[model samples]
Target: MTQLTQNNGQIKNNYCVIDLETTGLDNLTDAIIEIAVIKFDLDGISETYQSFVNPGREIPPFISDLTGIFDKDVLVAPEFNSIIPKLKEFIGDSILIGHNVGFDVGFLREFGFNFEGTIFDTLDLSYVIHPTQLDYSLTGLSLF
Candidate 1:
């Protein structure tokens, strides 16, 4: 477990930065194809939770190219409902952070997890902290 500053600067304990790759952009229409969560200590990535999900929908061609995940690849994987318990266990009481956390958080919430924790958006934060910088994508930030 680790701690980080929240959106309001209050100390948030047990920080977990999460990311999700899905069938499509819409959480209502699509499903989580792959999920990655890396727990962070003060120094960096401490623990991780990553899995492929069988979305039960045909993977769109564009998405397959984007994430390198094909429908056949996850055909044998667990469904979203089946994996919620494990996801919850991994995220227990961690303050969640991500590039566009709402997307990942929204997906989790749709699967019936309350997801009670402080959320900090590095994307939104970057806009405030360094508006002059062009790209604030998670990969871009990692490069810097």
Candidate 2:
């Protein structure tokens, strides 16, 4: 387990940044199609994992267009069940950081992964730190 620390109010190390590309927004109805995780420490990224998951359903046209991940792309990819163990191993007990972490956490919970570690949400933090900003979406924040 990696320990989380702060130096002069700045995050030090031992965090996992995760992102998921899903078929839709509804966690109960949608499915995860692609997932990526990068574990980083003070030195730099220590581990990285990424994979496309077969959602067992057709990817909606809008989602396919936005993500460039069509049904055909994941036709032979591993299922979510098969990916869970590896994901759990990669995350371990590191603090999780994501754009809108609650959404990701909801999807993971629906798939039966109980992530007990701390989570840092860039979306929520951005709202607090940049209250006047017009957008808090990941892309918006990135551009800002």
TM-score of 2: 0.90
Which parts of model 1 are misplaced by more than 4 Å? 1-13, 139-144
Error of 2 at 119 (Å): 0.7
- In the order shown, the candidates' Cα RMSDs to the true structure are 2.9, 3.7
Residue-level lDDT tens digits of model 1 in 7-110: 67787546888888988888788888888888876667778898898988899999999999998889998988888898888888778888888988898787
Q: In candidate 1, residue 56 scores what lDDT?
A: 87
For model 1 the local lDDT of residue 21 reads 90
The local distance difference test score of model 2 is 0.88
lDDT of 2 by residue, 32-139 (tens): 999999999878899999999999999999999999999999999999989889999999868899999999999988977888878888888899999989978877
Pairs in clash, predicted candidate 1:
none
